[model samples]
Target chain A: MTTRTGPPAPEIRHVTVVGCGLIGTSVALALRAEGVRVTLADHDPRSLSEAVRMGAGLALAAGEPPADVVVIATPPSTVAAVLRDAQARGLGAVYTDVASTKGRILSSAELTGCDMSTYVPGHPMAGREVSGTGAARADLFAGRKWALCPGPATALLAALTVTELAALCGAQVCLLSPYAHDRAVAAVSHAPLVLSAALAARFAYTREGADVLALTGRGLYDVTRVAGSPPELWIDILEHNAEAVADMLEQVVDDLAAVGAALREADGSARWGVVADLLVRGNLGRELIVDAYARRAPAEGVELEAA
Target chain B: MTTRTGPPAPEIRHVTVVGCGLIGTSVALALRAEGVRVTLADHDPRSLSEAVRMGAGLALAAGEPPADVVVIATPPSTVAAVLRDAQARGLGAVYTDVASTKGRILSSAELTGCDMSTYVPGHPMAGREVSGTGAARADLFAGRKWALCPGPATALLAALTVTELAALCGAQVCLLSPYAHDRAVAAVSHAPLVLSAALAARFAYTREGADVLALTGRGLYDVTRVAGSPPELWIDILEHNAEAVADMLEQVVDDLAAVGAALREADGSARWGVVADLLVRGNLGRELIVDAYARRAPAEGVELEAA
Candidate 1:
């Protein structure tokens, strides 16, 4: 391995984004917007060609020199394999990923015996209600959190290069360990996905629920928006992050049980307190989320809590 | 009751809205936009005056002639009492409400022995992340579902007037029995709210979860947005609609249990299938919600399903 263990390069002059899905295409476009030479690659030639037609990037020739950075934005299951191939080919000076789960990807990289010094497992805290390369946008990462989990084996220059990539894409860079990243995403992302799914799934088979689905205001609409993602894609995510997600989901299941008990009560005050407690806690979480989302736009004057 | 019973009116021109909260002020502003004579009232003089200054309406005088309609946009617990008092004082030709629950409010009117012919219980499928009169906007109900649950005692004239009001406010009017309305809202709106809160609450007390909360992407953010609603307000809603909300929550709790069971499995494919099944169902539900939300703007070309 070429030891470029010094300060970060000033800029990522040439980059290659593998797997031309939503995240890959978006990253390529973002990097391209910053006047970087971006190259697109995917197993599906048509997919990569379409991304190129959209001006995302040109296809990297087989004989092209190693890029300054390589972003593997493929499915979680294939991340380690793709990274190994890229490393075998000496594809870039630095390598990173945009998978939702990091623990599994990192472990897979280890098991596959890839060059670890160049790999920094990352996940962008951003997405839309829709997916696919067709839904990609250059500004997808703008002002969103982009977690960078640099392993002990990671070289300082490689970590710095990924940091530069995030900044150029207008993302707030966050440092997290692979294990820590997996657990955090499990609690807030993975488990919440299942929670939203289960709730929305209830309406799918229940006619009474469907009859009034239209009557639901923005509240239900917002709560279930993420449930629209392609099922097979989520299956891939959950399969890799199952254990951590299940742990977080187990706790939420307990909370639901408590809510059920409270709702069954005929006593108004008892039921009111249970609902209020959970809701108050939820208000705290929501505040944390909304504030973190805007970075600089903190909300104010929110004083309504349970009496 | 006055002998005013016939087909739906062409339009409702004169209206007064009580409560001076988010829903009340929004209704007043929407009515004003439709060239209707709108009056505002509330127990809090400062609130009503603030709404007036925002041009929501002029405050209704103690001795002014009754408007064509009086909209009671109050908390669920007090809707019946306010409606009864308004009916006793001959406040308007018809009365309606914008409470979230229907069964309890209807029961309260029965308990108070109010004149019910001029009353139509309505629940607008509209809200925002923020609330109160300060956050009121005239387009709050635009293109949203507005359910009108008229009892047998409801006069045709009264129902027609309310329909006109909903139409003028750019809402699509729906009809249901008060009992049916309560159950429907409980299934689609109320239960989903608790589901969001329960999922969010898990993250609240979990220190590990908090560390990663900022790292989460849009999936968690959308699922928990509704959990930010004022706790006291939600407590009132949950109390009034506890039975129905609880029933729906019971089903969701069971679904969560299923997910947890499937997640505990060691086999990746087995767990993957379960996640896929639930996520597929979720996709169906999400489509239903999205289609119903935008009247003429149905999404298309979404074909990715579980493998």
Candidate 2:
């Protein structure tokens, strides 16, 4: 396999993106904008056509490509299968998968006897409320953190090539073990989805909640926005990262119990103290997240309306 | 007390606003912009001076206001006490409040033996993340719902006068029982505060969460935006509405348990079905909120950025 080096080199030529969904289409658009030859492929013929129309790439039939890099941006449950199929078909010199849960992808790839060295398990920490090729943007990954889980066969040249790809898309690249990546995303992303779904379900069962819906404000909108995500996508995510998500859910249960006990005792002081502690900690957590994004790419004057 | 009908007879009359904080300052600005005399009052000397500089009529001492309408914009914990104190001093001909939790406000006013007829338990469903008079904006309440919890002494003249006040400030008037208002807000507003706080605390307790913080995206940011709200304010809200909040919390716990169990069993089919049910419900809940807000005042061109 040919290797590329340095900044803005002619090393990167043709790129093949296998899924043609939101993330895959987005990656293809970003690459095409950088003047790379992009090939779009998908089991769904409609998605492939949509990706092409969205400027992701030209529709390509299944076969080996004379491309430098291949991106597998399918759902978590299908990531391993797509990776194996692409590798067996000799799709590209270097390949990567943009599945949220990385550990499962790597494990499944191993079970399928796919080459690990030539493959990188990656997760782009960026997305929108909407899905499909329609939501794909060339700058979607700009200034966001992209986690690259490089296994043993991940040559330094190949890893650097992926990093360059991320940088070209204006994203910051971070390295982590596949296990660590999956666990971290489960805690921050997957667990929040589950928690939000639970909250919405709770409101649905309450008589007062009907009235609450009438009085809804930005507070509720912010907290439950993730609850509106596609349910099937979340099911795939939760099933892949079940252990980590369950652990977080149990912790949440303990916290809720303590809060309930404090409120039950009618100790205004204790209740306030407990609730205040949790809120302050939440503020700190949020600050940490904001700081991370600011470091990667400053928001650059995105004015937010007052809450 | 002399009550005049038909829009204060076009007189440049003074309007006294108690508390001189975020809501009060905003109200003062809104009223003053309409060429009305606005006298600001606050126990805090600093807030009093700030309100005066912000175009409110001369800062009044702690005495009866020589004005027509008085708006009490103090914190929930202090709403009743302040109203009672103001009424005892014969502050104004008609009075109202902007406290968030209303049932407790009325109950406390009753305990203090204040004339309910003269005081209206009002809450404007609008705010900013930042607090204090400095953060106040004249257009803060524009196109938002301003709920009026009228009492027995809520004469038609006074109600009409306040309704005109709401219209002048670009807000839609909503009248409901204080109890119903409290129940609605607890589910949509107060309950989400506790839920977000709990999620934040749980995230902070995990090592993987530390890593995830650096990879945060818009989803996490939107979900936890309210988690940054001042803890003291939430404590007061939750303490006053503990029973309602407790009930909501219990339902959330039940839902969480069901979701966790389904995922743990690797029951993808069941998990997907359950989450689909929740997503559908959540979509319904969101649509109801959007429609209500749109009906109150069409949000045709409101472009709010991510919080």
Candidate 3:
């Protein structure tokens, strides 16, 4: 029952992905499946060679023509520099970077004198615990949300091309501003990383030993599952969105302290109000997050909610 | 590669379960599968009838002969009272409970003047989002840890009988003391519940609306997954183990505050040390918890680690 109600789809015949990581290779493989020619590049020759071996795409050769779109799939810190270099080389008619944070990257790209009109900053809400080109799969973005945060100067053609690229890779589009994107991820993603780590860190310091660990159930397992992620990668992500994440973390700390105080109060019965309030809110919030996916499942078109 | 070095199994011909909730019914069903006659009881007649309909067991009849073992599967707050009443009625030769917390129930059971030597307190490390007999499964405890926290006065026969019961239900046994079990769960289960709720509560109050909700990925979803649980049930759990849960929550608050400060500091590069330390510990702790299960899989015998 859901339908797309915009202009005709832009033709994306050739695309170049700057980093042959999990996301880049997955994007290349996905587009290749749809008959779009994909060119791959990476600072590490092994990653580029592995992506090519995995049938993702051909390695970008020297003196190549400008492609329809160039995707910067590097880490968050390097996205702006890569975007500037790609634009300077006239790599594509439209440009986008698949970075987790948006505001910092957008501002840095602007500072580096990149053409903002041809750039549509985006992030795909799909990933695995493992990384690199070897772990990439074409179906990684099959049913995930691909967020497109376009600047005011971003040309409509550039936005349309990126949206079509997301669609071709089997993802729905979420439209929001750059600042909104960063804040949203800080609340949902970056903040949870620190929270999960904090919870798991308790397990590490416990003098009670393995028996204490033995008492663990599925709830603890699920809550701290992401705690085992590589620290270097998470540190970088947290650094870019530090302020927003710190704000969310402080909010969590306040709530935790309130609940802790309630639990330690002399009057046992009175503590229920403070404890139950946060829990009820948590239940409601969890439903909101879960329901978003349920509502978006049928409507494959762009969800146009911006800051 | 794993072998049992215990005495020959105890002959448990019949069993009586006092509460016909999810865990209680599952225990009865597991014993029934082992060719033991089972009798089920619940304060709610509807629950008793439903358990009977599901072939968990026959409903408890007036003046029935005492069974080999009695399992109390009531809520955490009501467990001690149920144990006292069951003991007064001469319910069975051996008695045990499946409450999540231990020290409170054991002390209360003693204060209420119940027989101490015959009772073994247990907690199955298994549950589902839904509760009650309707959601009960025969294999709910399969491959899960069933903690048996035997008091100093608890007889060997009583502890052995409960361990055998756990084995019959396809569970591995982890033996610890009452206070230790409470402290362990405070770290793993109870504390994680509050933490998950605190994380999810942010989404409930977000002014950014559905667009921010749409930005949620699997990481946030997994972290806050249990936040949707019923608050009344959780409040009761926290209240019973209030001090232990509060202690762990305070530790979490401290870690979060430190990380938040590090993120907000003026020096950008120096923050990695504090942030990465917690993440690395979190990684190690997660491995410890995961490895506990992996290590237990090959050995079905009791894991004898106590405080």
Candidate 4:
């Protein structure tokens, strides 16, 4: 991780995490280790109890004092409702939600006529195939990009509080527009998921083609790993932000077609060049990603939005 | 690794590995560790000297005695020349070539009028994106599939010597026909490579697309990792086994087109189902691969064919 050069900030005193899923539980665990008083809440009693049992945080009891911040650790679909509830009850001085999609959550909050100034829409770009409180870890956010989107007229205190929370979790806080977040993820995360699903799906359905996948190796396994992601969750993610995903996937489709044509042509010279060009591009793309992720500091990289 | 149940076979006494690249250096190291006397050779004087310095084996002198076995570790295109040279000189008791493609090498051996009875064609399905002797590791072949394909008239001693080499290197000796070997690797290895190259190649060519790759994470990286393989080396492997690779890629092309069409349709219901179906299929294919690689035992799984 890149070293921090700034003066130290005040420690967070109280944090209330709503929804005890993977991200929520992990966030709670991270905060609790920093000596913050963390209160955990979830509508699902079993999940709530699991998070508490795993020492993510203490169970939120009735009539507790206002927390320093309320993190809406729910699915993107439910973030607006949860934020609205937290605002109505004055649950925290500042609020944030770690949803995968940013624009949708912000739009939902705007529709509900909630206090947008106190809310920061967030997305921690870290996940695993297995999920839920059971799979949560304190180090989940370390070195991962935690994209935060603030609406116009957002209170400075609200943004600072959320940014502080991200720093506490050891995340690289990247300032992104809700639209940019959707686009970036669509290009990197969402499109890969769709592409992997498509490839694996084809391998499964062929009559004479079962043997094709039967010859498995590290290459094939690595290529198809994302296809195993839970479809129940993915269906929600894809349908919610289908437009950007569709756009990115179209580009991928065009690229795939070019290679397909090259392979099909009898004279492979022209098509072979096309194939090689794409491979080189993929190499550059992968290098760009690794460099961006590995080095989050220095002048070449963008720092978290100035406080 | 899964434990072995059989009594230990006779150990290989003297091994001579030609080429001195990653696989060659690694084979020499694995043999040397097992107390077998090993000698190394390469067309390039530097690589040969480096492997010797790294203690992979002693460098072959002008008049060294014939080793019990001579392993041709050259690139696929040069395997035939190396094996023919070795056979003509009576360099060893038997001969083997560890080229990625089998059919071409076997055919080349036959065309050059090499003694098929003393030569066995082999491929160890293990590699890194990096190349040359510098990347070699003693345990490189451990738990990997070392495919050995002998001619119909291969001598018993030659086949046994190659099998012993695989066992000494801690590899699972998988006996395959040259045709089957080519076809299987095409399905699992070559097609995935082409697909990854196509995806990454697309990422490189687009003006705005480069930024998309900069945001990459585990999904894109894993899918595109193998695209960085040295183009010169891949060109030989692909051209030699182009027919099988082309055949496998045809299936991939069909799958990719179906998904592409599904993504293009405005009413995504039919197309969405197409994507989901491929995902489920990919899951099964992955499971089949893992099972095949992991459990190389029992009546259900295929084993090294008895001589």
Candidate 5:
């Protein structure tokens, strides 16, 4: 493994984002707002054309020169194959991706014999409940965490260039291993999605019908906000990070089962302590997350290495 | 069961709100904005003073005449006792409360021999992550549902006056039995709080420390948003509605265990459908909630009875 880390980020003038989904289009819009030349590409012609029409960037033309950085913004399952093809065609001088899961993609890239020297695996910790290019906004990544997992074969120059790309889009960069990225996101993102979905699914089985939802307050609405996300998109996300997501989810199940049993007890006085303990821990965890979000903006352009 | 529904709401000239926490303060503020005379009361001197300073209203003075409506805005566990005490003092011509759970409070009120004829149990489907008067706002209940659970003994005038109270706060009124209200909120509010708490508590066990929370996006943040609520308050809510909340929590655990088992399987292809099915159900449920919220405004002043 390479013990060396990259220097400060270099100035980035041109970027090529190879998908026109929400994250890809948002990146293009942010780069465009920074006066950076951004070339957009997508397998779906409609999405590419719509993104281009929205002033995101120009569509890639035949024989266009390689850009300084190429962002593989495709779905997790396709990232490896896309990286392989992009590298074969010399799409850019350096390569990175915006997939939420990293370990599997990294393994796939290696198995497919893609050049790791040019690839800096990345994931921007940002998204809305909605998806698609239509929901793209230039400020999507502003004040967000952009995680970079550079393997041993990754060149220092490639990692630095991708860091510059994240900075240009107004994001903070954090460095960690591929394993850590998958586990962290499973804790923070994937597992939460599953739990939200599980909670929301109960609503469908309610005998009281949809009118029963009238009693719902802001609390339930907030907890299930992401349950409205497209199922197909989340299916891919959950499948790719299944083991890590499953691990966290299993722990949550244990917590719920214990709390449920405590509530079901006839002698409720002693059992309330069990329920209260979990709620108190929840308060601490939630405070930590809020504090982390508040601390992010001031730390922009500063790279945080995983402990 | 009372088949006798109230007629059109009457004009509410003055309101006496007996608590000065977030919901009560917000109610006071909203009423004050509508030119209604508001007299506030709280056992906590600081909260009462804070509400008054925030222009919520005057403090309740001894020998003051009865107002048109009295709102018991205390915690769920104390609502019955407060209602009994307020009635003994002839606090108002009609009475209501803003507790989140209704069935147990209703039973407790009956057991305490409170004057049910002058009382209506109400729950406004509105709140914030933070508590106390400091977080109160006039628009807290605007465009939200206010549920009134009027038992057989509740006077038509009492229910109508409380409906007017809700109207002045810009809330839509819905009618359901105490049992239905408890069950609905268990499915929508109280149970979701437990699930969110269960999910968030896992963060406390992360080996990666608080910095790992930096990986969180808006999805996870939204899912855990209400997990930061005061634990003591939630403990009371869960206890008051224990049976209903436990029922829903158990159902959720079953769904989660099923999905978790599916994810843990060595052969993942067959089990993906299990996860995907729950996700699809979640989408439908979330859509129902969003649609319910959107439909709340134009249906203002129309009371929907539980079927």
Candidate 6:
């Protein structure tokens, strides 16, 4: 273990992005736009060629000069393997992975006995319906939140390097423990996925669903649009974040029971009040979350419009 | 009982829309656009005048004038009372309503002994986030579904008049039993309201919600957008459709429990598979729903270069 402590002299001049997929290409483009030297690498030659065509980076050879910073933007399941391989080959001075769930990545690193100090785990809360390097845009991360989950041995220099990387991408960098990060994401992101899917399934089984669809409105669109997300990707994410996600699902069930009871009593006022209370509280909570992450424009008006 | 059967002739030359709110004004405007002479009436004189200004009608009247059709677009709790007043005053030859819930309206009509032959209950499944006559758009119901729940002894002429009204508004007319209408809507529309609110409430109770908001994405926005709906109106709807809404909520709770169990198991493959299955089926179900409605232009792809 390198016993070197404190911040290292800022020497990150050339950055390398591996995997050349959606997030990887986006980071490369963002860094390149800021006049940073960027190199691209990917096992898929087609994706590497696509990233190059998109001006993400200059294609680098296997034994090329090492970059100052390296970013791995592979899928969550493959993140640890890529990091271990890259570090063993001495790809860069410091490295990080931009995966959605962090706890699993940290655990993988620990189990593999990778150099924790040189590796920072992060997630940039940005994406669109489309995927791949061809769909990447440098502005993808603008005004978005990029979370950094640094292990105990993470050097201050490595942390600063990652912060500067986020700044270059026009992102607001926030810090969180890996456990907290997983739990919070499970509440807002993973739970909603399952809920939306369940709603869709229920509609499919209903007899009048066809007739109902003829009258479908924006309300249904807003609620179930995410149900169209890639199933395989979601399955992987849920599996990795099962513990925290399950807890959130329990809370949702409890609330649903209250709604059911209010309906059974035919208490219109209570039923409406129950739903209204949840919506109002959600609006307020969402506002706070957006503000802290600086994800939205400053709240200028009465934010609670619906509930 | 006027046992008027078979296809009723189109005798509704002049139509009057009472309660100049969003639905009422939109209906009036749509009819007027079809070159039908429309008369506007409302308890609020200002609202009445505003409807006329928006070309909803030629005049604002205190009492029902000579007309063939009358549309009552008041709140659910007030539907019975409004119908009683309209019928007592002989508003028109054929009468209908534009309330969200239908069972209560039908019940109210029965209790008041409103002329069943002349009364045809209906609801236009169309609206926006904004409210009032000023927010009313002429094409609000264009290519949308309009459901009609007619009672026994209803004259064939009244049904034809209502169908013509739906066509004039560019909507597809559907016939359903009042119970079915309430039950279907509770599953699709009312339940979403409760679910959205519940999600918001859960976020509000979290200590890290503020932090979480900073990391929010489009996923949260799409899911909780409806949680901002008007509380008073929702309360009225939930109360009116309490039984149907309650049953749907129970089913949702059961689904949530099953999902929770899947998550708690050490092997989350089954749970993950369940979620994935739901999403896949939901995608197909939602697509069918959208297709059953009018088709909108697909999103155009724009070439996004690095910033």
Docking class of 3: medium
- DockQ category of candidate 5: medium
Off by over 4 Å in 6: A1-13, A35-37, A43-46, A58-60, A205-208, A266-307, B1-13, B32-37, B44-59, B205-207, B267-271, B290-307
Residues A17-104, model 2: lDDT tens digits = 8888789999999999999899988888989998888778898765545568888888889888888888778888888888888787
lDDT of 4 by residue, B239-279 (tens): 67777776666666576566556655685466578766666
Report, in order, each candidate's fnat. 0.72, 0.56, 0.84, 0.48, 0.77, 0.61
- Candidate 5: where are CA atoms >4 Å away? A1-13, A205-207, A298-306, B1-11, B205-207, B298-306
Sort order, TM-score high to low:
3, 5, 2, 1, 4, 6
Residue B240 error, candidate 1, Å = 1.6
TM-score per candidate: 0.89, 0.90, 0.96, 0.87, 0.92, 0.86
Model 2: runs farther than 4 Å from truth? A1-10, A62-64, A202-211, A298-307, B1-12, B62-65, B203-210, B266-268, B290-307
Best of the candidates, lDDT: 5
- lDDT value, candidate 4, whole model: 0.76
RMSD of every prediction: 6.8, 5.9, 1.9, 4.2, 3.7, 7.7
**Candidates, ranked, DockQ:** 3, 5, 1, 2, 4, 6
What is the TM-score of candidate 1?
Answer: 0.89
Count of clashes in candidate 5: 0
lDDT of 3 by residue, A206-300 (tens): 66657787766778888988887778778878888889999999999999999999999986576789999999999988888788756545346
Cα-based lDDT at residue A13, candidate 4: 93
lDDT of each structure? 0.81, 0.75, 0.87, 0.76, 0.88, 0.77
Q: Report the error of model 2 at residue B277, Å.
A: 3.4
Q: Which has the better TM-score: candidate 1, or candidate 5?
A: 5
lDDT string for model 5 (B1-307, tens) is 2244456568899999999999999999999999999999999999999999999999999999999999999999999999999999999999999998898899999999999999999999999989998999999989888999999899887887888899899887889888888888888888898888888888775666576787777777788888999999998998888889889998888988888888788865778899899999999878777776666663434456654
Q: How much RMSD separates candidate 3 from the native structure?
A: 1.9
DockQ head-to-head 1 vs 2, winner: 1
Q: Per-residue lDDT for B173-211 in model 6, tens only?
A: 678778878887886788876777667667676666666
Clashes of 3: 0
Clashes of each: 0, 2, 0, 9, 0, 10
Error of 3 at A227 (Å): 1.8
